[model samples]
Target: MKKIYLSFLLFHYCVLLFAQTPPAQTWYQNSDGINTSVKERWNEDENGFKHGKYIRYDIASNQIKDVYFVKEVGNYSHGKKQGEWIGYTCCNYREESSIISYQGNFLNDKKTGIWKEFIQQDFLHGTNIYQEGTYVNNVREGEWKNTMGVMLGDGTVRTYAEASTRKGFKTIYRNGEAINAYDDKGIDLIENDKQENLNKTIETEFNNCYSIENYKNFRAKYPNSDFDSEATIRINKLESEKQKLILAKSEEDEYLNPLLQKWDSMPDTSKTVTFFKDYYKEFPNGYRKDDVKKRTDIIWNYYDEIKSKYEREGEDIGILNAFFQRYPNITTPSLDEWLESKIEKNASVYKSQIESLISKNTDESLKLALSKLDVINRCNRLLHNSYSLIFSIQHSLLNWKLGNTELALKEINIHKNDIVDFSSGKEKYSSVFKKYYKEYKLGYPNEKEVWKQILLIINQ
Candidate 1:
């Protein structure tokens, strides 16, 4: 029963101590000599720098004030300290005491760099060091630890490893020990082994920023130093690829309008009709689909005019019929496929028939047909599926006129190349195509090939 009562009493006392709020400190006296007092209006001390202590004065209130930091002892004007004033930690209306003994080096009146404090054994209670501080007004204004407390910009008063601030929270620490600190999520900010490495790296980089010269030198010395280097390289590469994509977009916009104009003006010849037919197949998503359809409708209207004029009309007519027979799925074969199938066999016959109707046909009909041919050329370059059989045949025809007879013949035989080599486009077809386009270029190897080769470089 006695033990239980003792435990209960101890718990209550601890709770009271933890909840205790220290009273605010007052400016009671100025050993250095700038006057701030309940007796007088306080003002800025102009001689603060010379005296080494800034403002000083006293509070006469009955309420106990916190500790005051005094520099030197003497009467000072302009609210500054004069000769040798000592610093003390006073509490309970100045009845309690804490003081540092100073000797040796003094720069002006302030302690230069390192000053050691000696305390009575009773004050330390078995420990070598003792420290404490308090708040005044909304600021963390007070005499701190055994050492002069440095007022942190964060509004916290620093006294050795312990700190208290405007927020009214306190932390206590032993001389040579560590603690795991956590945020609201219970995430350990310092001692968690899993994320400690990442945290340290981030902290180092952040601190490096304040030391610009050292940071730059470190980066120059180690180009691929850490994750930061890899991220920098990736961002640079992405920006370069984006620039290339922008240039490709500008090239695509150039031929769109002129091609539409040409399609509006053509005559219904086999080549003109075939051009628009392929144009639609290649560019289903093109802006000119309606224009191609309109031009196609005009051709059937004039179909009868050519039918009656030639003795060899039947031969040309058979070719058109063959196109329908071969591609039953094509509802619209722009050049009457029947006419084109017969063109080579009945070329001389069709020529004579065209001559007979030359005077009767409008010049607009001939001009429009020529324009349609041009539109088809531009569409094939920009939008066609160049790997398809029809595109290969067209490419062959175009290359034949450009005097590249070898490439023209190769294009016509693309199916044979695909059959002989299982790799097709990647191996046989690409080899043939690149020999003409890629090999001739300087300083730019096929990067895909180079990467593949690099992987196999160490193979036995």
Candidate 2:
């Protein structure tokens, strides 16, 4: 199995390596040569002085992306911090981490202007604590505000933020003089020493705060404070993390519930146009897509079958009708109209052949005419269950010509009840009978009297 490795490395190769460092760990030392969470990658002059773009971050594990982010980014002008700097929190806990935390400005290695830290989230779900204030020559000055509350996320810099439960501590400063200090709750901590001795523990494991200045101020105000200070002040935000939860599925449920299983279980013969069309709608991609490519074969396979039948037997209305019923849109020809035209053509062919036979009749000619008439009658009955009176009568005449009186009677018996209603003056076939009778009388001058016997047997 190929393992995905965390990609990050401190490489300098006239180097423009996209995105990340190698999976191997490399420690980043703080200003005091102590391994702090901060790591740095920046351009430096020939004398090893930081210059050009500078970036640093603490690496964390991300399930969605396996890459090292260049977190704290700023510019360095010849070994001196310059321009804007943004710091990000890191190290994979709970398979995720906050993308950004703090952004501030630096001028000649000194923190200046406004600075804000965003994420208060840690290794577990937690609250948000943020700091926004001004720094003059590396000294916290002007109106500095530290808020302990909650906020989601936004872009680069903001003049204000909305937190759900916001409690801000503000101190107004003028010419290096701390004039007033007040929190949102109006807690007068300035000149009020009551909270100085409050819940204080320097034990790093409790993971309380993440501000060095905050803890240092605590230690200064209350020297006897037993509060923790193992840089957990800076690490406390990591306590709140987002854990990726996945519900394990049973093997049977996992395998059988997919659409793929449904498709596999379907019979190949049952894979009709309607079935495959619905399957395409269900699974528009992947294996279904590959199967759709086989659609040409499937569609042509069916059309080819119909074509073969059409070639062998020549236009079976029953087969064409059944085909049109199943697949109406497969062919460009309107099958309904096409079938109607074919039936009319067949009917006309039968009419012409029957009319031509009236001129000269033989046992062989009558036999062939009867065969075609029987097929035409069968097709009409199969399609609409309606009797073609002329075809039926033609069948009887053929049998009468062959001297098969009983079969002639058998042939006319089935249409007996409907024959009168079928051949009534109101029916379309009545005219056909009249036209055929006018010509038919010339061929068999005894056809009228013979038709009388035919009629007698049909009614019987």
Candidate 3:
């Protein structure tokens, strides 16, 4: 009798626990109790003790997106949500036909789980049928792929991209490597094949110029050929070059003499950008420095005037050609200039702020600087919108460096969506942000006072 009583008690407790536990509610089911005029069907469970299928609704469209049905309910003849439920984006009852669809199980008046949907069958899914769908929470989820090849907007069959993602990257396999797919942008590249067709263009140019005796005769024989205009232009450039050739040796000598002398006197690696830029200015079209064309921007960045002038011009092609062929050293001067300016600005702000804090109190200064530094640190931690990240990081770094790490970190954390992880689980940030963080941490005794030790390690 005692054993039977104990067993009975255990069974009763289990039953009570199961009965008290509530079913999971779909995100759509959490609506407030008011139904709009356009709402086709709106029902909420009124029974104080009801548990299964608590709410059901239909809007302008007969399309069902959300439903709550519990299979456990043996019978509620009045209903356990049997009919289709529709949804719509209502403009005060306009009843837009473009309603999103949802199909699935519902329990206890809440979407208990998975739901399928149909978005307009706009694009092809790689060898798969496409339809739109969503999960219970109304979050966009589901593959529209079917088993047959279908063409995308570009007239090629591709594994369509997720609606929320960029289409440039296409899935080639279930996991790992993806094949490169071009969108409309890829269509434009087809014209680039014109370069390969230039043979006829070149032949026509040669005949018109008559640079080669035989080709000139050939053009004379075919006077009305389609390529006459092109041939004429090539002929003109060649004649101009032939006339200019007489001055080439003298001009070449003038350009190369100074550089040759300087290069001989300087050490190979010690030959700085400053030395090269001065050489170029002295010999504007020099041939000798063309060999050491790699170091020109080092000097260019140091000279704000020249760098600024190039940027103000805003002619990238001109800038590239001017520096690359004869002065390859200056090719990336713009980038160098940008980096230098940022560093100077940041350094100046940090120095002035820290100095002011020291005048008031050493601890206050340290705290302010630390906070600014942390902000910079956090901003660098983000990957979205590089410019935004740069500003955010700079703001935080300035605050942390000025002695307010707490506030800086707090502000930067607002961009939580920007954080990402690499395959190695390490964070990748903008180079400038990384550089500043490393410097700031090393500049003082941080929480762990590891900067000094790190410096020693670096030196050793």
Candidate 4:
């Protein structure tokens, strides 16, 4: 019982010792040309190690000028720092306008978990040096983000602002050693500044030209630039525009050549209905469609005059022949048939006139004769065999009169096979002109034999 009582007294004494409050303590010192002060509860463990909250400050200046301020604020465990800690700098002793330098968790006097470190350039701007990842047993592990920034002036003056204009990079750390640092484009952040400068240079060059060759040259110089994709898009657009311009120029040139060479210098008399007909047939959707219409009106007026003259004069062979001569590809069947009957009834008179015209021996005269024969054949709607035979015979006769036997034979041979092919078809007359076949046959009974003899002459 005495031993139990003595144990109880000893236990009460131990409780009193453990429950005593530690006195508040303060200390001041000068270092690095600045005065500093620390205040805390002088609590200590049995081993005489500090415990509980601790605070520190630089008192050299009420405003932060050259000295660090608010150095640390954190708790302690058996003299080792632990739990959340904050280290910041301030311009005032009252902690006004303070810059948080570091803030994060601690364990046994070692930094652990997420921690951020900042650099204060001025009162309002700061740079985040790093935002580190988790710490395992005081060793940095996993990813960390780092950033850097610079102050921007407003041309006339400078002002402190939040350091939001920062470019960031990611670094992988293992045991507090960085394994890799890279940006979003996978370019090494260590070399990012150099690459960024190069990109700016390329952009300046590109903006000056905005051409495909310019972009292509940029790619050639900086093959690994971050703006490669953008450059490619620009090149495609520029090349497409270039091709469109080339095609437009080609179309313009094509339309211009024929206008200058053929249509511009055509004679008034030559510009009959046939001239407009051929023009529309060749250039149906020409760029000068309005001009084509205007020119066509001129030819139509001439055609109206010819038609009126023919109706009033009752088929003067000379005037009828002249109209047909001008437009060989055109046919007026009734007018052509009336002229044909007039020629046959007065063969001597018509032949004399034709011989006089032929005596000139010009290309225009030859073309006119060929044109008249073509109109006659078309008006009569001759069969393919009969039409070819009659046209060839007439063409050959004209060439014979011109003493061009070789050219006449050349023309005959060119149509020889076509004539043979048609004769084998058993239709001696064109189906559309079957009613006129008897008159045609009577005019040329031995046309096939005649064409065959001409072919023999040509082959010889």
Worst 10 residues of 3 by lDDT: 88-97
Off by over 4 Å in 2: 1-345, 358-360, 382-387, 400-406, 419-456
Predicted structure 2, TM vs. truth: 0.31
Question: What TM-score would each prediction reach against the true structure?
Answer: 0.23, 0.31, 0.19, 0.30
Q: Model-by-model lDDT, in order?
A: 0.37, 0.54, 0.41, 0.55
Q: Where does candidate 1 stray beyond 4 Å?
A: 1-57, 60-83, 94-222, 232-460
Best by lDDT: 4
Better of 3 and 4 by TM-score: 4
TM-score order of candidates, top first: 2, 4, 1, 3
- Per-residue error for 425 in candidate 4, Å, reads 99
> Which segments of candidate 3 are over 4 A away from where they belong?
1-243, 260-344, 352-460
Per-residue accuracy of model 3 over 412-452 as CA lDDT, tens digit each: 45543353333345343444445656655524325344334
**lDDT tens readout by residue for model 1, 1-460:** 6534533453454344234442122344344677443222223445432322222323333455543332222333343333443332222233332233332233333333233333333332311232333322212222333322333333444343322222212222222121332322443433343355555765476355433344455456545556456445555566677677666545433444555566555332222445554455555566546765676555554444444432345433333333333332333454334433333334334334433333233445323322332233222222123223233433443343334455555444534344112233444433344443332232223445542432242121
**After aligning candidate 1 to the native by TM-score, how far in Å is the CA of 317 from where it should be?**
43
Q: lDDT order of candidates, best first? A: 4, 2, 3, 1
lDDT of 2 by residue, 214-332 (tens): 65555665565455344444434433321111112233234325644564676543444444554455445433355445653665576667657765867654455445544544433
Candidates 1 and 2 compared: the better one by lDDT is 2
In candidate 2 the C-alpha lDDT for residue 418 amounts to 54
TM-score between model 3 and native: 0.19
| Two-way lDDT contest, 3 vs 4, winner | 4
TM-score of 4: 0.30
